[model samples]
Target: MRKLILLVAMLAMVLVGSVPALAQSTLSGDQGANPPESDGGSVRGIITDISGSVVLVEADPSASSGPKGYFTVTDETEIARLEGDIRIRASFEDLEVGQQVQADYAGPIAESYPPQGEAGSIVILDEGGETDREATLSFELEVECDPPANAAFFGFIPAEGGINAQLTDPDEDGVYTGSVNVPKFPPGPAPPGTEPVSLPVQIVQVRGVIKDFGEVKIDGDKTFKATVSFCDDNGGGSGNGGSSSGGGKTLPNTGGVLPITLGAGALLVAGGLLARRLGR
Candidate 1:
């Protein structure tokens, strides 16, 4: 009995230390099918409120159908404010209520009660009704995926009305269509004499995780025609407007941290059980 007691105590201590290590070693280099592919999507609206990395966008009455979606802004995400002529780099610290913005996003949005995806870029469409010209950002997503997903969408907030495109499994192949109506602001500073008041139709930007991404050519296509335009009054520069970078918050790795923690927890439980059995 004494020898058995000593052996059990040794085994318990080994578990207390070794189990966690063994689990980590097993999971360290894991290459399991790389988490599900997050398809491309977008959300546009007013920054009605904000908290953490995700900000709430409130839509006006003319906006399209769909619940107000929350978008996750990442450090890699280009947070830029459109001054008179430039897309100046900024961050969450520059954002505020009533400001109009367009978020181009991709990847899987959270599956919580209200789904939210990460944003790759957040463009401050306008600082404050500085311009009356409505710019449209129109792009068609030619999609191709191995396994089909039920739905994917891209959205944009006009200075007044918001628009979003919803793509689903194609009628023929795995292809789909989507569009965005972004309230137009100047892409960059132009000559002081000419103000753009014409409604321009062109492919401003294309974002998505569609396998074999289709060509999004920016050849200054005919898509750019200004129905109405605004004169360049302010040259482009970064704005001090944005939500704090969470003071260098760790929202980046939040997705991968869960599995590691769960593994550690399981190991601790196993260790406790082994120690209990040994005591008995």
Candidate 2:
């Protein structure tokens, strides 16, 4: 009986030692983990408001339609990086409250009632369609030209049609500098005569009156025009105060034409007189 009891204790000790090894192997191997590819489709939403880790977003109705219609934006670190007030292409711009936008997203689905929310990220795709996405429709107001030493002039109000854009002048000069966040608009179906659709930034010529200046109120609105070159990933430069038709403009070379002709005529007359004198 004593020997049998000893043998039973030995067996228990061996089993305990082997249990840890089996657990380690399971953890190192499959470990019952789900792959990331299992998550399909994407969700898009706007950051309407932020409360702690919860982000209230007004998602696009067209994208979120059907059974999984409702979508909300949560305060996830990954999602915050992609948000700005106006959705400009390439440059970081703000999105206005009423402005429409699209978001790309993907995550896990809930299995229980009330639908437990899944974690995911979102990126701004588009603001509105072509008619709304033109550059000429927007305006950039210069607040101040001369900033304080080492300090830049800040704060410019966005007009009714445009979104609020902040400028950061690194040189501390009055020149306000900043990026505008534009939306990534999707391509439409190809028309019969048109070539296959490709994504390109739309260029526009802006023509409007400067309703108001920075914090300081100007006496009257200033009428001006500028050309905006914009694209999904990049945009560049502004040319203002010009007519669409290239006309009535004095070209550089035209000024010299009259002077050269007069000089040649004068020289020819002088040569004729000199020849008469030499012949006599």
lDDT tens readout by residue for model 1, 1-280? 9999999999999889988898887787574423322224555667776788887664552444444557787877777766555455566898877778877666666764234777777778855545433444443533322321223333322223334445333575544444444433345454332333323222211222222212222212222211111112121111112112212332222234788889999999999999999999
On TM-score, the candidate that comes out on top is: 1
Over the stretch 1-280, how does candidate 2's per-residue lDDT look in tens digits? Answer: 9999999999999999999999998886774452221123333444454344433344442442222222344444133222223222221233333333343333654553212243354344444333332222233324322212332221223433444443354564433444433322234432222211112211122322223322322212222222222122122212223212223332223244788889999999999999999999
Q: Which model scores highest in lDDT?
A: 1
| TM-score to true structure, per model | 0.30, 0.28
> Model 1 compared with the native: what TM-score?
0.30
Q: After superposition, how far is residue 33 of candidate 1 from its true place, in Å?
A: 32
